[model samples]
Target: MFESPNELNIARKEHKHLSFSAGIYYCLGGQAAKLEIEVAFNCLCDKFKQPRLQEEPVWRKNSNMHGMEMLMIAI
Candidate 1:
């Protein structure tokens, strides 16, 4: 489980993620955020012929935040 949170394993049958909070504390912009991501990915797919990673992603060092610090991609 130590390594599980470091990667995007979409194929996992079950998982737990709390990025947008939950219940009464749920993020109001969660849906909007999802929509924005979807639109951005769609646009990238339409605009780029074959975009690929230019280098390995650098992940953030913050224990409180789990995300990439730099993700270079080549179009």
Candidate 2:
């Protein structure tokens, strides 16, 4: 569904699918999760002067989910 997976656009609104699924399969905790992530990321950015990846990230093994299991970052 994503034409350019490498691109990052936090303000984009033309998504075909929600991160937490859609309709009857939608997650109730999606909003809370998103808020938590935003807070955490903001905290990290504020605290770290120069944050960077220390090593290659380890991807999760789920076919339906795309995420990292292990990501080592240096600040």
RMSD of each: 2.6, 2.8
Task: Give TM per candidate.
Answer: 0.76, 0.71
What are the lDDT scores of the predictions, listed in order? 0.76, 0.77
lDDT of 2 by residue, 11-30 (tens): 56766766799999899998
Candidate 1 lDDT, tens digit per residue, 1-75? 435666544355553457788889988999999799879878887999987778877899987977889978799
Worst 10 residues of 1 by lDDT: 7-16
Cα distance off (Å), candidate 1, residue 25: 0.6
Output the number of the lDDT-best candidate: 2
- The residue pairs found clashing in candidate 2 are none
Off by over 4 Å in 1: 1-3, 8-15
